[model samples]
Target: MAHVVSAMASETSPEDLTDLSLEQLLNLEVISASRLGQKSSQAPTSVSILTANDIRTFGWRTLAEALNSMRGLFTSNDRNYSYLGIRGFMRGGDYNSRILLMIDGQRMNENIYDGGYIAQEFMLDMDLVERIEYIPGSGSSIYGANAFLGMINVVTKQGKAIDGSQLAGEIGTFDTYKGRVSYGKTLKNGTDLLFSASHYDTAGVENLYFPGYDSPETNNGIAHKMDDERADRLFGKIKFEELTLSGGYVDRGRHVPTAAFDGIFNDPLFFTDDKQFFSNLKYEKALNENTSLLLKGFYQGYDYYGDQAYIVNDARVINHDEASGRWWGGEAQLTTHPFEGHRLIAGLEYQYDQRQRLLNYDLDPYLPYLESHRNGHRVEVYLQDDIQLLDDLVFSAGARLDYHHMLKNLQLNPRVGLIWSPLTNTQFKLLYSSTFRAPNAWERDYNAFGFVDNPLMREEQIKSYEAIAEWRSDSNLRLLGTLFYNDISQLLEGHLTGDADGNYALINAGRFHAYGGELEAEKRWSNGRLLKASYTYSLLTNENRHGAWANASPQNLFKLHYAEPLFDNYLSLGLESIFIDSRKNGLGGKVNGYELVNINLSSDKLIHGLDTSFGIYNVFDSHYQMLGVSENIDVLRMNGREFRLKFQLTF
Candidate 1:
């Protein structure tokens, strides 16, 4: 667990948070919960923070792996993309539009599909990440859209933290290799500069077996030498005084071994490429003792291209699918103390989507199947107030209104929270909020060979209620609990229309309800020893049919993490365990439950300025499967075991 530090007025200069005692750290202050620095107990929602130390100790390879260790979240992969499951509600093959992702306070979701890429396709390398802030619950009242279930903000390290140049390299199982070079320095003129670049490639598994495709022509159920992937990333940042500029870019390509979407099996031509780029500029200034002003502008773009090999009239043809998007946005915010007990925050935002295009074609005959192009914009205004009614109690209320030209609709969302401190070390909170997600261009206008367009699709909505409690003891132990329920309506889902060719269409499902509870316990020692555990239970049902929802996540999840310093503080060991219950596969069949064990060993001071780590994932070699996208492959097998060794030197 990351130690909480004292609150500061400026958001960028948080170097103080790195140096704090255990007792002070227990009282954590989170920024994403309220868009400002505040104690966890006083914030409107429950917050979880993971620091760069955690990443190094646990040897987490990706953002998905780090987030899965949290209390009430899980992630699944379809071999093409990774999808996040929140509160036991997950739709297979989803693009992760329900969760909002940010990097240094800038949105990462693109304009066309609104997809939040979390795996290797993500723009930033894990080495540059300073910390991750997770605020679980609806945040549309502040962020406008795509904040239905959770808001994750990834904070990057400052130039002062690095202070030099660094080079790193890693080798992993399946012929995987990675290399990185970074430079950061703060000059005597009070200016800071940072830059980093990374490259990764992997041959993937030598062979993968799919029982559903167990035919002689499909290489006897085995796909060989077709799961290769490669990626490259570049990032940079500059800061001086009240102004900051930062940008990042990533390009990745992955081969599809499962032959999803009725592609030809054992074909190496089936693959997809994704490229994403974004740049942001921000300014912060203090107008007076009681008022502050902030401004930001950002531009982001995305491009996706895919090739699927299929047999048509006993001949192989490649289907080329392409999509591209470009968007730019600006925001202005003001924070002031209006009264003796009231703090007010107000902001306005506008976004212009310059390009949203999708197209599909064949290379041989050069036949164009589908072509769509469009542009749109959005405007939003939000305000929030936190009032201290008593010495130990606070009330918070906020709302936002958004107008979208594409949807031709206006939406308003609200949030309210009440917090009370009954004892010196105990606190309680009650929260209520509502959020919505508009259908993206992919769902509303994508008409392809195996899909139909639905231009009249509407937005989905959710209402959530939660109660939370926190208690801390003098023995360096902390416990937290939360109970919550959510009502969801008009969920967009792909439905089989019973056509002879098995064409699918996107439609809004009627209604759904989910209830869950989470419990977490953490203990820390003064000698660098730590123990943490958490359990989550959720039940999700379809209100329209009075039955369980299809492809929903497991009802129970348990996770544990432990770390200990060894060899006179020269080395450390980290261990973790994860258990996931069985889940339905949407085909009236169930995927069995499984558990995993991961271990890591690392040391930063053993060789002075040199850091090294060794990690083994899935030590027990557990066998498991996850729900797939198409009917041909209803379930996809998971990886069994892997190994990685990394070294970094700073000069």
Candidate 2:
């Protein structure tokens, strides 16, 4: 399967460059390291750029949804939360602390359980996002700790992109509804300001299943319980000359059931309301024609709560928990062209995080409360040199040193890359890098059953390498192919001990190796028709004994998308299909493979002075699960196939 896809990708024409307006393409810069003065093709890592157009084409409503279509990205069925695993390493429910998420260069990873939580509930609204830059390799050298797997940087929309006022609304399966409004203006002082707000609500589907667990006498039966989610978000951005400032707030709530054992269980209501606020201040000043300084500072906070009820040992238990944290950081960057054909970038960064958590139970009123607090400080210095060794060749090397106050350890990471343009329209690049992950607060302090914290947890490390070949064709066809491998060591895993609680303690006792290849192609027809396709194949193996562990990585993944304009200047149609190979859940249980199909039709035409659009998700009603949780007896499902429709207007 991989060979076939590779052969087909190689046959694509090599003269095509992306067809985009200068402004639109420049907007992609927010996520493009090349645009950020990081050597583009020569960066020592694998990176994918998702432009605003890509987001619009997918009709995504959130950052999690927007990332769903990527070759290596997947979301849990719950939709409200998602995880990104590079190669084959990934964390379970507590993903935020394992992966680092950034907005406009500010760290958003909050000190939580064992790692930072993504705070998916409070992430910027999709309408406020301009681009997403995904680096799928160890970024600890440049990003630190939570960036063990990779880093995702979300760049918000600027006022210049908002041509006028806009409004949109959507309704879908399971009584789902969403609405959004955006406004932008240029002040007399030449400063650009933009504001956006959006809301989403859903009474979700009843497709979940609890094995051997059923209420034969009830109308709701054993089918998964009904779930619901609500979210409200607001964002604002101001740009004045070389400085840009942006921030946002979000309030989100969700109700979910707990994992059950057999037919006897408790139906729990899970609620999470997250409030986040962030601001970024950047200054770009040129000291000379060849030297420039970039300064950035950001602060973010997460006020989060999780409330739920569950049945344990045939006894009903209710849990009310609150977790809150604040994170702030600043960076200073200097870029200098000290010699011909060479560029140097050096930067220093510092970040501080603090969190407080409490858990109380109503059923066991006499039980003592659980309280936990954590503080972390990170400081890093990095330098990169991009040398144009030849007219068509570039060599780049970089290094970073990081200090973690909690661990009292210092780490040094290094990266190297080479790019060669053997042909005018073709480029071949090679990259290698080493990155590390620090333990999260929860991972180090939480004392829950089934899990334990280790203060002496060694950092997780990965040595990754990739080779890519890309070609552009005159016929508007572009092809890109990459082969990659990753060696992971010092992974944090729970070592089961015969303790009274049957819990496992955290230890550096796991190792994993993974290799994969990906092929992507896009073609543009003269009549404005576009076709895009991608395929990914990966193989992963665990070298440690934990449980009934097997290959957890999906073996095959594919995507196809087609888009065309219709009805003159008023309408567009997009068709998409996604496929995933069968894989094991976190518990190492196998799941059946599935495919999904989606269709979207939109119009920008004026209908009675209103700009409107409508879209349908999961058009084929394919039954699929986005996430699975494994316990002693059963596997719990989170998401299933559903439908959605949306409309918008402007006054």
Candidate 3:
């Protein structure tokens, strides 16, 4: 398989420069790095791209799984929610508010929590993905907000790519089942349309034990039948001429087993429901060969509902949490290359948050504790210029200004980078960037889960400096290396306040400094073998509290992936592994280090238009404790082993 792909890549037309030096070939083409579509080799940051082929070959069931295999990035799961940790920077109470997730250049973060879900709760199913591009760095100068640490762009498969109806089904560990239905086509009038819907459910673990709830009446720290999950999703897209319309909907339900927040044990009253609906329209026109104009508009709606059984003085107090948000935004961009030495891209963006609502109540007693609704707006503009200073050097510089009602000052973020291509298939880069995250409505004024409101919360800021190098050797090998330093200020943290049973208050009183580096290597052989390996080393310390910051994820992470074909392309085997170092837990003790191994076997062309796959996760059934949020100071024991078998048919 590897050799086949390489042969196709090597078989390009000579007029297209396939036999020329790779550097000169790249020089003739440009990349959409940072949304400017500049030179690929001269992009101002480190990027990793994976296509649908890679996703299928690895049997990746979710986006989080694919991301965890990458260097300098990983995710944590407490069974209730999943959080993304990057560059040793995800704190105990953080909600993934610093990263930006986009589907075809449209934002996916909710308005209230501002979290970018990466697990089953993630918006799009893995089967619909065409490619995923991950750009790691501070990108506020180009994306405005929530692009603090990195950006993930998910591109869906076009209608022409599918060109027919498809059905896929799977049965997995813990009584899990999934099914998908899809249809796509290109009409005779040059119209393209695609649609897909998926349904999933799992019985989850039968029982879980938590040390915090150990007691005679509590079944000795065990909760029975408390873990279950279900979800439904739909997505569609239409493209005609220069216009495109796309939308999606996701609804998820997850049951909690840890009995967090002093909730009753072994009860059915602990669950959360997350729902989202979004749509976007885009149009582009080229005025001339050197100039283009584009416009986009989007609408998003979100709702969250949670039910928990709380024991207040031994009384059964049922808390019903509800929230909603409605947002609409528009953008205009102009790209031009007026002269030979320079290319420029500029854009203006505005968003109106028409409604943000939050309310919580005691359902049995019919008591309302808090209710708030707000309306706000934001405006931003940015410009970036890529200049060819010399034959071998490229310089890039940009800045963005944002205006928001809650902001004390207009935020201005700047980014600058220098790329040096001193030799063929080799590049070095130096980059400096700044980014900030605006306080959300919940962070500003909402009271829930023993958390008090702080309407005057300030924005958080980050500054970073990084160096990177890349080389593509002649012997079918690629190497990447990166080193970075980050300084953060005015971090929004939940502070304990008031009397003995004090409520958690939102405050901007935390600070941190971190440094990290990562190295990765890859090889593809003509004998149909592939290999990838990566290692990351990092250290993070809190300047305000004088302790390790977000140390739950390993500071030292190593990963490997190897794949090969067997039995004349009728079967393929993939092996994967990850090793992580020990880290501190919330209760002042060390969580042990652990390793995981996963294997997959897939068959293509076993029969006409039919494919199959079998996978085993946690091959050794290694047991580990997953850390928790600070406010909910309870660790969740993860599942031991899991297996899945899937089949697909196309007619």
Candidate 4:
């Protein structure tokens, strides 16, 4: 298989891209995740690339909005709380512990609770984002522990990418307002610096269906007051040849209304403030004509106050508390091509996390509070061979071995891929990979209301197989289809032990299977018009557990996007449609699914130094839910028909 793929790849020649638009850059190869410059189709897993043009066309305000349109990805809203589940397994807000987020190869997910706060929007200013590369599968082989669910790598804009300083702002319904300013400069010594700041505020829309309260004296009630939110953020980056450094800070505060309250209800307040700093240094020395040695190192720090809630029940009850923590880690990697068609990558990583709870209502009143801390060290080595057997086929295989100090366990992940190009414009690929997820801090030490910690938890593992076919016609039509199956073992399920205090401890249990398929097609017209569409269907079943079939796994997900030039290259119109099938919530109850439509009209013409845009989201005001957890406030309310008009000027 490897020989066939290598031969086919060598037979084909690269294309000339002088006429391709910026939007077409989505098809370019992604280099961040794999540390290898490989196209998404060649990867052994599901990968999605969102280009800068796509971001602008969609008018996405945050990373969440951009991800919502992707196939196989799901999102749910719960006021200041948000949840993301990929493939099938999903939990509510504070999911950073399971999924991993990286910025320019630096880990950003907080270590506490096994996750970071996803609802704290505005963590990354959209204006500064150059592009986003997403891989929806286990990344533990390369990223270590938190790469359980998948990886989202945010690629920021460099000073070289921007022409000069720019400023922009927007105002819309529900008292929503946003503003941003950025500057970029290049030094004489081939170095560059870029800085940006943005702010967003909103008086949230009314999402509740039922109006006022009913009393013994009357059955009539008034409409519930809608919750509101406000946020601010700052980001900066500097680049010097092979070395890049970046940092940012974000502060977000929001207030959410209770389900049963009008003016006399509970109002939960959430505040999250986080800081991120990281640097990447790389050096390359040529060993010979066909061999070279490359070295790289990265360090990152993330600190935040996550989901601190002040709960007021009825009139006499007052519950106030907060959870805070910090996570810091560093990685060093070395790569060498000692032989022709052979590549070797080796890395070592170390991470330490400390969590402190200042106040806990459930802890023993007399016992002294103990600050919980967890430190982890991981060392790994991996090697791969991309053999070029013939002019039309390519074969690649690799394996990774990692040692974890906390788990006292060693993991081995292996992957193999074969690419065969029978035709100049068509490719067929087969891939198989094994990956695993280490138990997070929360899964091991969480002892809260009705949830007990399990110290002897085992890591979860998955073996996946995938096949893909892609055809790119010379007439500007592209079609792609993929089929995949995953066998998962060591799934962690909570073991319930009913105690006097109604607390339940979690014990690892169960094995599962997940299978899915995706199809996508794109067409580009000669007149600068294009259409993109995709569909995904998946089934996730817990083979060991009875009556556990009705969870948040959608049977069908579909999307359609259209873009056309309205007036030469100065004006354009964009439309998008997203559809999701009905699925069950965490409690095994059915939830309705709906379709959403959005439209945007924008231009690249600069008036003075300003670039301008006008757009509308939820054009039809369709009501829908992104995600649903058990008994949690259902995030069913959709953003109403809203208009966002903005102008960005560059100096």
**Which candidate's lDDT is highest?**
1
Q: Which has the greatest TM-score?
A: 1
lDDT of every model, 2 decimals: 0.82, 0.64, 0.77, 0.61
Candidate 2 TM-score to native: 0.88
TM-score of every prediction relative to native: 0.96, 0.88, 0.93, 0.86
Q: Summarize candidate 2's per-residue lDDT along 434-491 as a digit string, tens digits.
A: 8787766666766654566567887878888878887767676778788988888888
Model 4 spans > 4 angstroms off = 1-27, 32-37, 94-96, 116-122, 138-142, 206-226, 258-265, 268-299, 303-317, 354-359, 362-371, 525-527, 546-548, 606-608, 626-635
Q: What is the lDDT of residue 323 in candidate 4?
A: 51
The deviation in Å at residue 293 for candidate 2 is 1.4
Q: Model 3, which residues run further than 4 Å from truth?
A: 1-40, 139-141, 448-450, 497-501, 526-528, 547-550, 629-633
**Model 2 CA deviation exceeding 4 Å by range:** 1-46, 78-80, 113-122, 138-141, 206-209, 215-225, 260-268, 311-315, 356-366, 498-501, 525-528, 545-551, 586-588, 606-610, 632-641
State which candidate, 1 or 4, has the greater TM-score: 1
Q: lDDT per residue, candidate 3, 1-651, as tens digits?
A: 000000012344222221233333333222252342344455777766655666777788998888878777877787887877787767544567788888877888888877788888888988888766676764323576788777777777777666688899999999999999888888999898989999999999877777666788778777778888998999999989888898999999999887666677767889999999889888877889988877888899999999998788778889988889999998888878889978787888888988889888999889898798988888988888888898889888888889876677899988888889898678898888887889887788777668888877888888988899998877667788999888888988878987477888989987888788989887765554668899998787888767555557468889898978898878888888987677677567666667878898888679987779999988999886568543333455578889989998766
In candidate 1, list every pair of residues with a backbone clash: 4-25
For residues 553-588, could you state the per-residue lDDT of candidate 4 as single tens digits?
Answer: 677889898988786767777898988787776664
Expressed as tens digits, the lDDT of each residue in 114-220 for candidate 1 is 88888998889998887777877643335668877877777888877788999999999999999999999999998999999999999998898888888898898
**If candidate 3 were superposed on the true structure by all CA atoms, what would the RMSD be?**
4.5
